[model samples]
Target: MEELTELVQKYSNFTQPMIDSLLTEIKNIQNNYSYRKFDVFIDVRNDYSHQAVVVYHKPPQVGVSLYQHKVVGKEALQENEPGVFHALETGLPSIGLLAETQENRLIHQRIYPIKFNDLVIGVTIVESDISNNILNSFRAKDTLERYNDVSATIQLFGRLDLAVTDQLVDSILVFDKLGNLVLANKTALELYKGLGYIGNIIGLDYNNLSLDGTNFKSILNHFLKVKVSKNLVEKKEFQYLDHYFTIRKLLNQENQQLIVLIQNVTEIKHKEAEIISKSVAIREVNHRVKNNLQSVISLLRIQQRRLESPELKQALNGSISRIMAIASTYELLAKQVSDDTNLASALNLLVSHFKQLNDTQNITVKSQIDSTIVIDSDRIVTISIIVNELLQNVVDHAFSHDQAGTIKLMGIIDHNIVTISVADDGSGFALDQVSTSSLGLTIIRSYVADKLKGKLKISSDSTGTTVAFSFNN
Candidate 1:
C-alpha cells in the first residue's frame, strides 16, 4: 500500500498538495490495520529499488513510523521474484511471500501479482514468523485469492468497455461533470498521430481536442445544454490535408459520450449538381429535335403536292410514310423520356399508322403482347420499320376489292426472344410464286434477317399468308 502511494506521489499528474493528502490517508489506513513484519518495495527495474514503508514487530525503534526507518540493503533484494517482475512489466500491483531467518538467509518464497490496467505494477514482500508459518500461509493464500477475484473483474470490465469503444464509428470524447477524456479508441489515437500530437488523448481535457483549428469547447457547451437529440448533423466545412468535411454529431446518453462523426460530402455533392445540369441540357435538346422534325414533315407535304406522274406520287407517298414511322417512334421516346423504349407500344402505334394509310376497315390489328417488353431506342426504330412493311403487304395483296378480310398482328416476348407475326385471311401465295420484287415484303425480310440477326418464316396456304420472325429481345 505504501509502495503504491509513493509511486502515485512520484509520477502522478495531480497537484503536489493532492498527492501529499492522498499519501497521508494511505499511511493512516496502514496504521489502523496494524500490519506487521511487511516491507513495501517498488521495483520498476531489476537493479533499482525504491523502499517507501516497512512494518515490523520486535521494536527496531519503539515510536518510529515505517517511513522513518533506515532502508535495508543490496544483497537482501537480489532475488528476482516473479511478483516484482510482473509489477515492472504491467504497471499494476503484486505481493511476494518470503521466509527469511534472522541470519538473513531465504528459505521459501511465493509471488502474488496486484493488477492495475490488467497488469502488475508493484509488490509487497512479507517475511513470515517461523512459529506462525502455517497460519500465515493460510491467511496469505486467502488474501491473494480475493485480490485475484477483484483484479480479474476489473480486467474484464476494462476489456469489454475497450471493445465497445473501438467499435463505435464516431470519435468518442468522454468527460466527467468537468470535461476530460478518460478513455479513447484506436481512431482517436490515429487522429492524434496524424496531427503530430505525440501524447496520448486519454488524459487530455475533452474541451481541448485540437482537430485542425476546431476546438471542442463550443461542441461541449452545446452538448451539456441539450443532452438529447434526434439527429444532429453539423456541416462545419472543416478542412484536413487540403480536403473538406462536415462534422456530424451523435450523443450517446447511456454512455454519457459526445461522439463526432466526420463526413466528407464534397465529391458526392458535386456529382449530384453535375447530373442535374446534364439532365436539363438533354431535355432542351430533345424538345428542339421534336420541333425540327415537325417542320420537315410540313415541308414534305408541300413537296408532295407539286409531283406530276402517279407512279412518282406513289413513291413520294411511300417516302412520306417511312419518315412518319421514324417520327412517331421519336414522339413516343420524347413523351416517356426513357432510354428503355416500350417496343410493344411502338409496334402498336406503327400498326395503327399502316391501317390508317390503307383505309382498310377490313384489316384488324390484334395485339397479344407482354406490355412490359422493353428494347433500346435503336431496336424499337428497326421493329417499327419492319411492322410498317408487313402491314402494308397485307393491305396491298392479301385482300380483294370485292372481299374484305381480317389481318391479325401478334407479338410474343419470352425471356430474351421476341417473336412477331402478321397473318392475313386473304388471297394467299404459293411458296414458289413468292417474289422479292414487292418493295414492302423485301424491306421486311431484309430487316428481320440481316439487321436483327433473326430468321423469318413465311407460311402461305389457301386461307392466308403468315409471316413470323424470331429475334433477340
Candidate 2:
C-alpha cells in the first residue's frame, strides 16, 4: 500500500507535523468504520493546481466498494468530484450529493473538512451507492396521493408517511374542505405542542393553530379563486409571540385539501433586524460627528478674522480646508448609512468646499472620478486630506502672477488597483529643486504609506505636474 505521508509530501502543502497527526486520524477512521456501509477516503488539494489528490482510502468492512481499482495518488478533477475541493477551500461540509467516480460510475457522497491550525488541510469523503437510498428520496417527494376520503389518506401515510415525514425538519399540516385538520405529521404535532397547544391537533381546525389566524375559507378563496394552478405554492412570513415562521401553502385539486409547510426562521429574522439597526445607528453617529467638526471649523474662521499676521491667516485657512475635506467623507457616510462612499460624489463635494474658500485664485477644479470606485469612509478621509494638500500645493507654486490655470483630479480603478492622480495646467517645477522635507511631500508620503498601504509617484515636466498614488482595492 502507498503511504499517506509520502503522498502528502509529494503532492500537498501539509507540514511534517500535520502529516504525522493526519496519519493517526487516518488510522482511527480505518479501525472505527461504522455500520453505515460507506467507503471513507481522504483527499488533499494539490500544491500547485486546483485539482485534489486522494491520499488514503478505507473500504467499508461489510459494504460493496464503488471503486474498481486503487484511486490513491490520483488527481480528483473538479468535474468529477467537486465536493472534495469545496470542503478543502471553504472549510464547510458537502453532504448527501451525487458525484461521478474516476471509473465513470455515479455514487452518493458526503464530504467534510480535516482542519489543522484553523486551515483546511484536506477533506474526508464518505461514499455510498445511490441506487439503495435514491428510492427513499424520490418516494418521499412524489407520494402526495390524490385520495378522496380521510380513511384513504390515513391508510397511505400510516405505512409510508411516518418514515418519511418524521425525518423531515419542517412541520407538515393538512386540512380538508370544511377547514378540519385531516392529517398532522410528527414534526407538526411536536412544534404546535411546544407553542402551547394542548392535546392532539389531528382534528382541530388549521386556523385555530395558525399564528396568523387565517381561516381555511380565506386561504381557499385566496389560492383557488385567484391561482388555478394546483402545483403552485404561495409563500408568506408571519410572526406570533416572538416566534417567526415562514409558510408554504399549496392545494391538492383532486381532493380539495389545503397543505401548509411551516419552517421556523426566528433567528434569521432577528439577525437581519440587528444589522439594519446597527447600520442606522452608525449613520446617526456619523452625522453628529460631522456637525461637531463643522462647528470647530466655524470657530477657527472666527478666530482667523481677529488675526493680523498674513502668515497666520493663511495657516488658519489651510487648517479649515483640511478639516472640510475630512468632514465631506462623513457627510457621504451619514447619508448613505454605509462604511464605503461613492468616489465621484466625495470628489465633487471636495470641489464645492474648495470653491467656497478660494476667493483670490481664478483656478477652476474639475473632477473626473470613476463612478464605480467605492472606498471605505476612513480611508477616503485620508485620501481627501492628501488631495487637499496636493491641490493647495498646486495653487501656491504651480502658477505665476495673474495666470489662469485648471486642476484636473482623476480617480481610476483598473485590475483591482485604484490610482488617484492630480494634474494641473500651470508652470511645473523641477523635482530636484523642490525641498525633500517639504510639508506637502512629507504629508503625502506619510499618508500614502501608513494609511493607504500604497505607493506614491510624482512626475513633472514643462507641461504640468501630476502627483499620483495607487492602492489595492
lDDT of 1 by residue, 1-473 (tens): 45444545444333455444444443543574343444333222222243222221122123333333343322233232323332333332322223333254443333333334343333334333333554354344444443356664344334333333343664444444344554454555565444333233454454334333444566666766876452443445555432345655545454555555444455776686677677556656656675676677678778878988878877766766776677667667766655678777887777676665556786566766678788887678788778777776777678887577877778888778988888888889888877759677778878888889888998998899898988987
- Model 2 spans with C-alpha error above 4 angstroms: 1-168, 176-178, 182-187, 221-223, 226-230, 254-256
Structural similarity to truth (TM-score) of each candidate: 0.48, 0.61
Give the TM-score (vs. native) of candidate 1. 0.48
Pairs clashing in candidate 1? Answer: 91-121, 92-120, 92-121, 93-114, 93-121, 94-114
Error of 1 at 23 (Å): 64
Which candidate leads the pack in TM-score? Answer: 2
TM-score of 2: 0.61
